[model samples]
Target: MPLPLYLLALAVFAMGTSEFMLAGLLPDIASDFGVTVGTAGVLTSAFAIGMIVGAPLVAALARDWPMRPTLLAFVVVFAVAHAAGALTTSFPILFATRVVAALANAGFLAVALTAAAGLVSPGNKGRALAVLLSGTTVATIAGVPGGAVLGTALGWRATFWAVAVLCLPAALGILKGIPAGRGGDEATGKPALRAELAQLARPRLILVMLLGALVNAATFGSLTFLAPVVTDTAGLDELWISVVLVLFGAGSFVGVTAAGRLSDRSSGPVIAVGGPLLLIGWPALAVLAHEPVALFILVFVQGALSFALGSTLITRVLYQAAGAPTMAGSYATAALNVGAAAGPVVGAATLGTEAGVLGPLWASGLLVAVALLIALPLHAVITASRNTEVQR
Candidate 1:
């Protein structure tokens, strides 16, 4: 892989840390801002909303700009937003900072993925994406827990400051390492917005986007309520919660690594196999949630399957939208965030009923099943079409 790709990963690590660390700081933010925990939690929603809205908007607007400059500008804005967040005590101001930071984050990721895809040959796109996504998995394992510890010891403001400082190295790396105007579709002229929009409007691309959304909804819906599930269903102590989460993160790392290699051979097989694994794993989790040993094993497997599927699904989208790689990358980001935002709502609603912890697992499994049903036929159609073309 290119050095710039790793630099892009570093930038992604910073954004991922900022995206997830808020969960650990929510309590502190509530206390400091004199608001309810639920009110402080709105900051997360604000961030996701920004991602869903900002990704395509920014990608569309900046499609013709040089990749390095666009990425650097977004990172600088992200750092500034974090710095502002660190200084703000007012709830509203802090909330606005989260939204702005998320917009920058979304824009950066869209460009980074597009650039990463362009850095390598067609056969290596999946692996390149895997390298880029490893940053997020690593963040879940280290950065999020570290931020929680930092918040507990130094306070939430200190954590924000730490994230702000973290962006400097990434910004500098992007500025110095990434080649200018290399990955963009348009080098000397503006991107054809009508053509990009037309590509995005394809039914196959829409199906892939739906697949992305459903898969994320399946994984995140249960994951959003993992703490409650671990405690309520498995009868585990609170301390064990961290252990389970760490195992999940480890699984994600392993899965994405495997996906990088396997998806290079073909995204179709990976998606076909991994999607069913998720469908199987979720229901097994639901059934095994009461059995501590079984539940722990299942959670790790589920995490791996979820992330592996993510890489493959994105590869599939790239394949379908070969003409609009950057816009397609933005669409994938937005779809995942949409699912991320919705999953929690579904989980929360389910928690209120008789089903309790198991509801999310079941809901997630059903969504995955729907996705698999859609994906298998779509893959078949694409394969058949390709075969027909080859024979001609």
Candidate 2:
């Protein structure tokens, strides 16, 4: 609702493009460094791992710090990481930059989530989050494709340089837009690290975060290796990579838009329906990998289902951990990045085997199924409890 919310989204767009653009750059990166594609994928996992570790750590450190300057500092670090990455000569140097970039991304997202939910009333958190995430979905449509083209024409380093430039405006936006002090969620007292850790032991909260991690694992696991799936399994030209990615982004926009509206009202039901459909969709995508048209249609379908599922799961996690508003954001972010980290590992492992490019799809299907098995009954109980409350 506030100008800062939009600015946060703008910053997220630049970070997200850095994250997703790797899909298109993987082949080129691998070739440049004389490594296997699977090896190059370690960059994805490394980034996720950085986020997984950094989210909570950074959030805890910055809990009492002024939110605006903290956010701006992270953006500066992110931009510098990209500049270093663009100038990197070896894979190891580039890999270190990815880790640094991801750490900054994790810190920014943790603070932004807290700031976003704090901007609106209790009921609008979902929509607020959706607005924040819109930057990421929009990145798929425009930023990612643009990065791919840049990577294709001028070299992957150019895309990194462009990302660095993009971060400049985002940093300015943070400086201009964000308030001068800590937000509502960043309580004014001394840090309560113990209370935040206590939130981790709650059974329901743990389950919700697990669901978040699992769904994202499936979503990102498949996404991390999408280029190979497009070029190899689908038998499409290299040119089609951006097209399919755009389609996926378009579907994701629609999905997150709908989920933002529905989640506040019917999180349980929406999560219930979306999870199973995604579990089915992942396997279906694999089966039809050989068909170009099926590839196009299914990716969109997968994107919609995956993001809708992801958004709702995260919104639910936020609510579940809201008791510790001080650290809820860091925990939610860590949970999601846990999945982001693991997903690529699965994709990379499968790629190493006979599954090749198709391996990621199967891994995604398995991840979703596990996530659904855990989530379905929980939502069923939630739905019934809500119905009881209404009847009473």
The candidate that achieves the highest lDDT relative to the unseen native structure: 2
Clashes of each: 0, 0
Q: Determine which window of 10 residues in candidate 1 has minimal summed lDDT.
A: 383-392
Candidate 1 global lDDT: 0.77
TM-score of 2: 0.95
Candidate 2 displacement at residue 94 in angstroms? 1.2
How does model 2 fare in lDDT? Answer: 0.86
Error of 2 at 103 (Å): 1.0
The TM-score values for the models, in the order shown, are 0.88, 0.95
What C-alpha root-mean-square deviation, in Å, does candidate 2 show against the real structure? Answer: 2.6
Q: In order, what lDDT does every prediction score? A: 0.77, 0.86
The C-alpha stretches of model 1 lying farther than 4 A from their native spots are 22-42, 87-92, 152-157, 181-191, 231-239, 290-292, 382-392
